[model samples]
Target: MPSLPATLLAFLSILSLVFGGKVLVFPLDGSHWVNMKVLIEELHTRGHNVTVLRASNSWYIKKESPFYTSITVYNSGGIEKELFEEFSRNILVIRRQKRSFWTKLKLVSEVGAVFEEMHRNQLNLMGNIFENKDLMDSLQTAKYDLLLTDPAVGGGFFLAYRLGLPLVLNVRWTMHGEAHFEIAPSPLSYIPVPGLELTDKMTFVQRVQNILVYMFSKFQKARTVSKHYRSFCEKYFGSEINYKAILQDADIWLMRNDFTFEFPRPTMPNIVYMGGFQCKPSKPLPDDLEEFVKSSGDHGLIVMSLGTLFTHLPEDITEEIAAAFAGLPQKIIWRHTGPRPVNIGDNTLLVDWLPQNDLLGHAKTKVFITHGGTNGIQEAIYHGVPILGLPLVFDQPDNLSRMKVRGTAKLLDIAELNRTMFLEALKEVLYNPSYKENIQRLSKVHHDQPMKPLDRAMFWIEFVMRNKGASHLRTQSFRMSWIEYHSIDVILTLLMILVLFCVLIYSIVKCICLKVVLKKKVKTQ
Candidate 1:
């Protein structure tokens, strides 16, 4: 005996479930496929239609899933692949060199140029794909409800703008980029920029260095990347849109970081922390791997992986790592891609890949040696395993630096790594009960949230759709320029006022002194 209104509301709810939204996702890096897969699958299970536009080399789209649609974009002129190859070569050079900080900075500047070239190629590919009449017709017919993209990839933002869809930025790393400042308050005073490897508890000198670095990064972005991105939009979209302003228009920011691990900073309501979303229930180890772990007995185990990109290490470095592992009593499982090292001992097992999360979850696991990729670090944190980090490049140094400060990890410079140094660091982490205790405490904090990270991400995504872009959540600062946002103009005005007041007081005092002198002279006469 329900009322007509109640019956109609129930019907509408059913209708909404039946006809869920269509979401288009543009992932930046190939490694991001693993992370995006989790969110994409969840959205699919919830009756939402999901489509991913991915590169051909993307390992995430192995076989088509029944849950979502996939479209592969070609490399076009092989430029993207070439740029990646050049980048890998440069990394090898940097890894082998024993250079000063300034020398390393110069090397990285060259690498940044490579990145710019790669970005241009990606933009060209995106432009060609979006401009295709057939693809455009099909996309328009599908009528996607929202666009989810990695802000690191400028092309995705341009595509979203062209399609006239609400945009959600999904950053797959803990490190927020320049675009983040436009949406949230990321003060350089305390929050160190990623890649600097500086901690939040910085000395006065370090703060000054941090400020200079931040300004330099801003200048670099403006001088190089932003202009190209703006040009791309104008050329393709036929509109002159401010690139940074487009970032502010984003509906939500799905950042892959937890506050527990990061420095405390101001975050906007629209930014959601979906860290550890990729940390799934550990799958059963393969038969041989399980047997290997069982054979290790009381000595425990050590798992080493330098992530997808850093899989191939130099032979000398590999031999050093092998020598360290050989000295350890624990069984070692190393993920490596290059030729087998000559020094790998009987205690070590080498493989093309390891079930990283599953191996970390093993009870026998003692410590994780990693490249300090955000995914690997988060996974290690989730499993309560201590880390010995060989941070290679980009945010790896910074990520490991934070972990070291938190007492859960130790970091070593890859350029200076030797067998003795590696072994000493490993022994310290493995023997120290404090590292285990600290990591366990952090793991608890990470897992103690009310809702799971994936569920939280899903809720916010649906919330954005429900509210139609969630414009109310945006801050007024989003529309402000850098000077206005930081209130530099206001500070300057106050300084000028103070100067004028001081001048006025000095003039008044001087006039009073002249009058006293004149009165004294008159009395003498």
Candidate 2:
């Protein structure tokens, strides 16, 4: 065999790279970057081009033309629903602060109504998806083949639908649960329990308000999703569609769930399970960070981070966390993004940001006090570090709830933060061999998959794009109406009819017997 010349080799490499495809990933969720930061880099190394479109948080781009073709929205504060969302978030914060059931119910109801009205106005979310025209144009100009998205917050899904490219939804930690799975037509309630954000000891009124609010939002998005689903079908593929059809036709679905931590879903060729995408050790910690870890040595460090969104934490909560950390014998490194926790002692370090995954991988790192984000859980498990989950909102509680049951992590109430509880939890996690054993055990399971998630994700994407829509592979179940999707009532009706028929037959037999007895008595007389 002749070795190719260097020029020929370079030319062939470039040719092979073209068909390898490019992914247009829109990170609408603030953590989209945090979650996919590693995955995209990996894809890039494997002869794929990855371009990130910054997402904007708004229903529509008010400006006719913008600087970038794609918008990445989150923490940009451009959300069209900003006023209403703030109101809703405020309701939770104030309710937690005031501790009034009636007041909370009233506020929740009002917020739910606002959600409905917002839907009526045809506003979905204020993000890149809502105003992704430039991305749509790129579909015509650029050879981008796939739209990779977490899909909860961005315009990538909509643009993918519009461009006739395959759409992939990454099950990044449950921002709102799997309800985002329904493609927005049916309802947000379509999301499974694992994906929902539920309150503890909720009242009936609270539940009513919660359902109403979610319905209002779901219905609002349904109109837009349905409208786009139909329009994109004809424009891109010369087809028409409904929500279920769009959902079923998705080329690839990536979930953060893994066999390591949870029960398995029946595997699908179209689905790639990549639950710990966030936790993969991608890079070496900087010299500064490595030195910090080396300095800890055997003393063992306890790491704490509230995750990205809670930078606006009240001073009181920060103070409580500080008190707890100060009381601990172990060194504490808190990823305090906003105001530093009050009164830091010598054993604690307050940094705006740290290499979270690298720190977890350190031998000196023992215990993790985390906000219980799925990303953090994957990292903790990856490094065999036990965790104390102090969940604040959304899926944090659920993640902790499941992890605690799995025995890899323990839970501490966010409302009940203090020195004793904090110190005790940290000490227990640091000293306990069982937590480490459990995490390592789970780590094996999480890694036991046949292939890494990206390979599977890429394959399915290319497969669908080549197939020009895998309509043949889809199940007819996708066409089912809402009535059929929830068929318990229909089953109950059939059962009731069967029972009534049996009762009627028994009554008829009793009447005939009574008549026969009467005739016999008359004849005897």
Best by lDDT: 1
Model 2 regions lying over 4 Å from their true place: 1-18, 55-77, 80-138, 141-143, 172-176, 179-244, 263-269, 282-284, 338-342, 482-525
In angstroms, how far off is 448's CA in candidate 2?
Answer: 2.5
State the weakest 10-residue window (summed lDDT) of model 2: 60-69
Q: In candidate 1, what are the lDDT values of residues 398-499, reduced to their tens digit?
A: 788889999999888877889999999999999999999999999999999999999999988888776668777777786777799789999999999999
Could you list the CA RMSD of all candidates, in the order they appear?
A: 4.8, 7.2
- TM-scores for all candidates? 0.88, 0.71
- For all candidates in order, the CA lDDT equals 0.81, 0.61
Query: How many clashes in each candidate?
Result: 0, 18
What clash count does candidate 2 reach? 18
Candidate 2 TM-score, true structure as reference: 0.71
Tens-place lDDT per residue, model 2, 482-507, is: 67867877988999999999999989
